[model samples]
Target: MSMKLITAIIKPFKLEDVREALAESGITGLTVTEVKGFGRQKGHTELYRGAEYVVDFLPKVKIEVVVAEDAVETSLEAIAKAARTGKIGDGKIFVTSVEQVIRIRTGESGESAV
Candidate 1:
């Protein structure tokens, strides 16, 4: 079976919603990381100690999930619907082919490993 890696960069506040959505869609495991970056939304200004400063990199959450190819579309829909805020900086979803997967503990490979 073919596999894919779905990476989504989303607003920090929406992490829980995305996780719940993925779970409801039958996605059992995923990895999340705290990240910072800027896109078309560019960044924003913030006040700190009464001083206004430009925040070039906004806080974001990166979610990485590996699933069977057949599950890709459902996973994408789940993520998109859950992550979208109808505004800028809601985030991006990237899909890439996964050549292989291995379960280190059991030495299982391919679809089963996933």
Candidate 2:
């Protein structure tokens, strides 16, 4: 079966809720990283018009999970539900196909690598 990698950029504070939701959806492992980025809203600031404006660097959390194709939709829904705060700067999610996976310790493949 094919596999997929789901990467979601969400507000830092919602990480815990996302983790819990994933676990509840039967996802056992994931990776999280702190990140900063800009989106459609672009950058905003307030100060002297003539001076150089420093763009605000918003704090975000990147969550990565690998799962079987069949599980992708559920995992995505779990993350979306858990991360949604109905506010700005919530971030985004991206999904991509994974060709292969290897476990460094045991050399496991397929779902085992997940």
Candidate 3:
């Protein structure tokens, strides 16, 4: 069976929206990581102790989901639509090949494992 991996780095605040969207798409499994990074959106400047500072590596949430090939586009669209904020720091989505998946408990692999 064909399988795929999708990784989305989104603004921290959008995590809930993305999660709900994914669930609505019949996606029930995923991995999430608290992360920090920058792109064209770059970092921001903040005031602390009456001082100005350039805060690097904006806080972000990395969401990783694996699914059967046919579900890829739907999942991508759901995540993108949910995460969009009409702002520069919306973040990015990446899709890549996943050669294998394994569910240790049931000894399931391939699409079923995902």
Give the residue spans of candidate 3 off by over 4 A: none
Candidate 2's C-alpha runs over 4 A off are: 44-53
Best-performing candidate as measured by lDDT: 1
Count of clashing pairs, candidate 1: 0
Tens digit of lDDT per residue, candidate 3, span 1-114? 688899999999999999999999999999999999999977889999999999888999999999888999999999999999999989999999998888999999888787
**Which pairs clash (backbone N, Cα, C closer than 3 Å) in model 3?**
none
Q: What is the TM-score of each candidate against the true structure?
A: 0.97, 0.88, 0.96
**What TM-score does candidate 2 reach?**
0.88
Question: What is candidate 1's lDDT per residue for 1-114, written digit by digit as tens?
Answer: 789999999999999999999999999999999999989989999999999999999999999999998999999999999999999999999999999899999999998987
Please, what is the whole-model Cα lDDT of each candidate in the order they appear?
A: 0.97, 0.90, 0.94
Ranking by lDDT, best first?
A: 1, 3, 2
65: Cα error in model 1, Å: 0.2
TM accuracy, model 1: 0.97
